[model samples]
Target: MKKTSILNKLRSSGLRPTKQRVEIAKLLFNRDKTFHFTVESLGKHLAKKTTTKFALATIYNTVHAFKKAGHLSEVHLRGKNNTTYFDTNISNHHHFYDSETSELIDINDNEIKFDKIPKAPNGKTIKNLEVIINLKN
Candidate 1:
């Protein structure tokens, strides 16, 4: 991502384009593909690849901020650790989680069909639906 575009995105997301945020955005949006990452793993990558150093708390804050801005999505799967994985793809979709390998594969939006949706409570509307299918070999 170019500097101008990154700055614009930060501004649009109501985030101040700080040095650390810029670097983090570059690390995130530089590629065309989507991915999932944890705060610890992202911090390690930044430490090895970039000259700039960011604290773990900084990474957490940036991740949450991006999620709030709709640039990232939270993924949940069945696991003992229950570690969090933030996905770069914010589009509507489902996931297939492999319990053996701990891999998450995106199920396209058209792949699944919802025959029936339970009615929401009064005065509330359904915002989104998340389906995670567990798989094992």
Candidate 2:
């Protein structure tokens, strides 16, 4: 993505387009397709790209900001470890998780069918539907 475009995105999201945010946005949004990453892994990936490196806390802060701006969503797996995955694809979709390899594959919304959906609580509405199908070798 171009610098101007990224800057515009940041501004539209009410975020100041700082040097660090721009670089982080490049890593997060310049790709052709959506993928998932944790702050730790993202920091490692960014460290390999350039001589300048961001602190681990910076990565977490940037990711959280992006998530708040609706550019990313969290994927919570069922486990005691409670590792978090960020998804770049904000559109409605499901995921197939390969637990052994720690891989996540996108599942098109139309591919899955739900027979019925239960009612939400008195004042709440169903915001989203997420399905994480675990896989094994």
Candidate 3:
């Protein structure tokens, strides 16, 4: 998407088109599609760019706010550090994690479908279904 269009989309989503937000949005909105990035990773990537400099806390706050605003989805990767990854694609789907390289790949929703959902015990309701397939090699 063009820069102007992206800025317009952000404004339409009720997000303030701040300098930091725009820079971060460009990184999140990739050319092909979805993107997976951690706060630290994103900060590091942004730091490399001389023009844009954002604090880690700012990144965290912006990301959380964006997620809450329904612009992004957060995924937690189970491991030693319990790292969190943000997904640009907001659609319902699964992920494939390469444990060896720690790479995250998106799995289309159509590839797998649940015909019947099991009964939820107690009063808990199923809000979202997350499937993380860990790949080992």
| Clash number for candidate 1 | 0
> In angstroms, what RMSD does candidate 2 have relative to the true structure?
1.9
Give lDDT: candidate 3, residue 106: 95
Candidate 2 vs candidate 3: which has greater lDDT? 2
Candidate 1 residues lying further than 4 Å off, grouped into runs, are 76-79, 121-124
lDDT of 2 by residue, 47-99 (tens): 88756668777788888888888888888665334578888988899999987
TM-score of each: 0.85, 0.88, 0.85
Worst 10 residues of 3 by lDDT: 74-83
Residue-by-residue lDDT tens digits, candidate 3, 21-124: 88887777645778888888889877776387798887998888778868788876674357888888889989999878778999998887888888877999
Q: Which residue pairs collide in model 2, if any?
A: none
lDDT per residue, candidate 1, 64-88, as tens digits? Answer: 8888888888886545457788888
Off by over 4 Å in 3: 12-14
Roughly what TM-score does model 2 have, to 2 decimal places?
0.88
Q: What's the number of clashes in each of the models?
A: 0, 0, 0
Sort order, TM-score high to low? 2, 3, 1
Superposed on all Cα atoms, model 3 deviates from the true structure by an RMSD in Å of 2.0
lDDT of each: 0.83, 0.81, 0.81
